[model samples]
Target: MQPALFAELRRLYAAADVAGDAVQLPLLDATATARALLIEFPQASDWPSVGATLSYLADELALPRPALSVSAGGAFTLWLAFASPRPLPQLAAFFDGLRVACLSDLPADRLRCHPLSGLATVPVVPAFDAVVERWSAFIDPGMGSMFISEPGLEFPPNSERQAEMLAALRAIDDRQFARVMAQLPTPPQAAMDALPLAGHFTDPAAFLLAVMNDAAVPIGERINAASALLVAGRR
Candidate 1:
């Protein structure tokens, strides 16, 4: 992990009004490189149900239950330190499933699972870390508060929509993928409307490209936009 990102994470933990002692777990081969997962709740009142859910998931996944950290903020971070390198695709799939199952209904809050390997030179680890770092800041409460407060704004797509978006991206049909991207409730009208250059572009390819390249927008939204464009770009 970059020193800056590590410092930011430490700051987040330290700022928590209430927090539990960190629990270190071995995620890969027995080594000094163990990963940590931190679970933070907005208040002590929210801990029981969230704790129970985490416990249930730990039991189901055969992973250790994460210690709870109560705080005034609503975000939770699951930091995984891998002893050995793992394939990015495999890890992404596992974390995606876990996030959907565990965090689908959580309100105005975010759950992020990041995998870090001690060996930074390992293939894909640096790139994956960059992606996580970018998206982590992109989803911060400061950046997302406006969208979260917007009426009818689907800040995070539901399970059904998530599946649909993923399928559209994987599908070979560019037109179908574009249609799905166009209909998504995220990257709200305000975002799209702000893009005057994209106003004349009705095709999904141009619209998605516009969104992806817009630095004013959140990285998560841009990533989704990029995914749609990638699917469309496939010939």
Candidate 2:
């Protein structure tokens, strides 16, 4: 993190409750502050969408803001908003939606497999490497494109980011990885590598179906859903 960005993060944390406008002047030099906010920031009372979060930041900083686009399908989408003009509100909204998504209230049989289509309605935001790893467990490797699309960003979402996420899961138990991957679209090869045989699932398909059917699963499950996708196909 840049010094100016780190200072801005400290300021944001200290003034978390302060309106955006209150701290805008002091944070102008801190471009990395937005990235840090996505990393360690706590979940807010409401999960504002990436666009909404950006709007909030723009309102706070008094900068020109852009419209946020979200997909209706995958967990990866929630982390895509940061590339937009507003990264904060999108992440906030994403967290809120994830809570709702974890409830598994939607009809699994009726749900289509659109990768990020499910998250299309949710918001996106910038996240730190850790947070990305945390969210990747829910993405289906097959479903998630090797690249992410962001408005105004010429470069696609970093492949290294996804690799880092896979590394994080690899550190956990296979059962834990299976449990997490169950809720996602389809697992990728990289994510599938995170699971240990004999981990929570007897078969990857079982894990995926289990998570899709269990709407009552918690946010942790939703976060893990990203990984389940990979396991399912491998089974």
Candidate 3:
């Protein structure tokens, strides 16, 4: 095993910061306060979108850069480390704002942030994907486009290199987090709250329209539906 691989992963993404001796993979719970946040871009062919999103965060939002990783299952993840544990609710809101801001063309269905779900399992890395016969690794962003078509490493990455990339990443600290959250368009809709749109309605507007008209959907949900519809329509 590349020992430094896990060492770097643990340093940045671990749910609980351990001192000097802990060796287990992060034991994460859906509702637990988080020390790291992962925003995964799932479409294998959309490296341009990933690049654009990065530009939006840096050139526009003026936020610190996150370490990038290619996942075992074919996605590019922007992994943000928090210097201290922070609540998930506001982070979820911030992610939603990013989606609505930059990725309106990309369906939210294909994007992911976690461990925001209880049923989900956060695995140990260099996690193997048996189906694809590939492994996950942190990547240099300059070379990220190469992975779009064949995401994930066929073999393990260099341990020292992995450690360097992870080390170079700057964790978002308290002041930065506050400023970023404040920049969020007041009350960005938590897209997780909107995930229940029934499967039959492939069209998002149709789903929201149905939600808006259905008295059974809570009044707040209906309002959110209308708000989403308005936001979506304007774009």
By lDDT, the best candidate is 3
Compute each candidate's TM-score over C-alphas: 0.32, 0.23, 0.72
Off by over 4 Å in 3: 1-3, 17-31, 119-121, 186-235
For residue 221, what is the lDDT in candidate 1? 52
For candidate 1, the TM-score is 0.32
Model 3 lDDT per residue over 62-170, tens place: 8778888788777887877787776555565666667667876876456666644321335555556889889988787788888877878999777677777777777
Pairs clashing within candidate 1: 35-81
Rate residue 100 of model 3 by lDDT: 66
The model with the greatest TM-score is 3
Task: Sort every candidate by TM-score, greatest first.
Answer: 3, 1, 2
lDDT by residue (153-214, candidate 1, tens digit) is 12322334322322222111334223323432343456335543425776777777787666
Best of the two (2, 3) by lDDT:
3
Better of 1 and 2 by TM-score: 1
* Candidate 1 vs candidate 2, lDDT winner: 1
Report the C-alpha lDDT of model 2 over 61-121, residue by residue, as the tens digit.
2322221212222222222212222232322333334323332343332222212222221
RMSD of candidate 3 to the truth, in angstroms, is: 8.7
Better of 1 and 3 by lDDT: 3
The predictions' CA RMSDs to the true structure, in order, are 17.2, 18.2, 8.7
